[model samples]
Target: MKLPTDIQILEKIYKAHKNDFEQYENDNSIRDNKIFVRVDLLKIAQELKVDKDIVFGRLYYHLNHKFNYQNAGNSHVKLFINRGDYGKDEKGHEINFPYMTSILAGMQYERRKYQMATIIAIISLAVSTISVTISVFL
Candidate 1:
């Protein structure tokens, strides 16, 4: 039998724990702070009749690369699954671009700062070498 796709596996897990997942999502105490639904991975695995490792590997890969979902904590134990479009606008477009943009901008700023520091270090070295040579000649 063919293995299920990552999305299919996730769907199965959601279906198996529909009530828990929905309750978790609807609970302001949980959803107000975090955009994740905590679920027991071992239970989901047993319900789907799949190995826990396979489920974890697929979930991790999809979360990081495809942005279909985000997960926290260990899949072998429990996991918090957050939808990619959790905070999207009504039209399904991301409404929080400023937050993500600020993050990218911060990363770029750090990169530029490092580049400038390296340039300054090289120039300082060059000046120090020149001064040493002049002292030797004097």
Candidate 2:
């Protein structure tokens, strides 16, 4: 398919990872949808002077988390799947999934922050309970 310039680049990247992306399809359509996200993130990373390797690493994390790591993770592929065209294979339905590194990083960082907050809240609650119990005894 004749994808836009940006999408063409993205399609190339997706095709590059044919082994990992084969489950989606041997087709390069996955690259088309993911290109927008990768380019946008790359632009932002360039603006921020972030290393491309770092960005790519995070992107890989997103892909693994979305596809391989099923437990305790959201369906990251669903968004891209909704954006692009997917067809059924000999097995079943397949969709193109794009993993944005920045987003994946942010999601992990946010999850950590939430876990920390929950821990703090639990500690505070326990301290309050202990304080109340001591006061009652006193």
Candidate 3:
């Protein structure tokens, strides 16, 4: 019933909702799996018994270009240009599904940045604690 923090997690919750029901007639494919497109956010919230804002925030975080809403109407307004990762345009630009993986990866590049930072912090903390202990003893 708890709110999902990230898009990938939210997607999992959506799938769970889809599975419990029997009326899903269409699907949105992710890799080999067909993630159903028939999403009912209100129903999902009711089923999970979570707050609407939390679920909505999760949905908005993803569908709104990963919170890239700086410009009020920056995204494609026309329906044809809003094909997303589902089709090819006139220029043969085959859009691929960049969800789950790409959004999380991005061009940030530093994959293990947090792990390295944590190691450095722990080392510094230990060294400082040792220095303080020595000064106290002295």
Candidate 4:
């Protein structure tokens, strides 16, 4: 049997989980603005009678070109198709998934590093103030 196109697969998964998407949208508990659709690699592979890796490879090939893929734990993957829809820069060009993911990950790492440095500086200043106070008392 011929394999389905990436768009076809995405449509099938979305159709199958329409209720889930709607429920998620209606869920006020979720504060995150980003929405994603999850697809179970194993389930798709079984439905298509193809190897799981092959299915994943096909998805990677198509999605990497436009959408970011996040391994959502277990055998499922999250699709961030909106990333492609939104323009990243002034030029209105969408960055590919691999590069965009890496850039975002790097930004996150830098933010964490800045936070850690701020914490350490605060602690160091506190220690120095305590030492000066003790010296003054002595």
- Native-vs-model 2 lDDT? 0.44
Considering lDDT, where higher is better, how would the candidates rank from best to worst?
Answer: 4, 1, 3, 2
**Candidate 2 lDDT, tens digit per residue, 1-138?**
221232223343444443544433555665443233222334433544565444344434444345443335563333232222212212222224344333444665777899999999999999999999999999
* Residue pairs of candidate 2 with colliding backbone atoms: 10-35, 11-31
In order of appearance, the predictions have TM-scores of 0.39, 0.36, 0.40, 0.40
lDDT of 1 by residue, 1-138 (tens): 456555455556555545543564467664433324444555666766777656555655543344432347533321333334333312221112222233335556777899999999999999999999999999
Evaluated at residue 135, the lDDT of candidate 3 is: 100
Worst 10 residues of 1 by lDDT: 89-98
> Which lDDT tens digits does candidate 4 get at residues 1-138?
777655445444545545544565578454233244444556667777777666666655555545444565644333333233222322221222333344445656777899999999999999999999999999
* Model 3 agreement with the true structure over 1-138: per-residue lDDT tens digits: 455445444444435544533333343233222322333445556765776555554554444454333347665321011223313322311111233234445423343686689899999999999999999999
Q: Name the Cα RMSD for model 4.
A: 17.4
Clashes of 2: 2
* Candidate 1 ranges with C-alpha deviation above 4 Å: 24-34, 68-138
Q: Candidate 2's error at 79, in angstroms?
A: 7.5
Q: What stretches of model 4 exceed 4 Å from their correct place?
A: 28-34, 66-138
Mind sharing the TM-score for model 4? 0.40
Q: Give the TM-score of candidate 2.
A: 0.36
In angstroms, give how far residue 71 of model 4 lies from its true place: 23
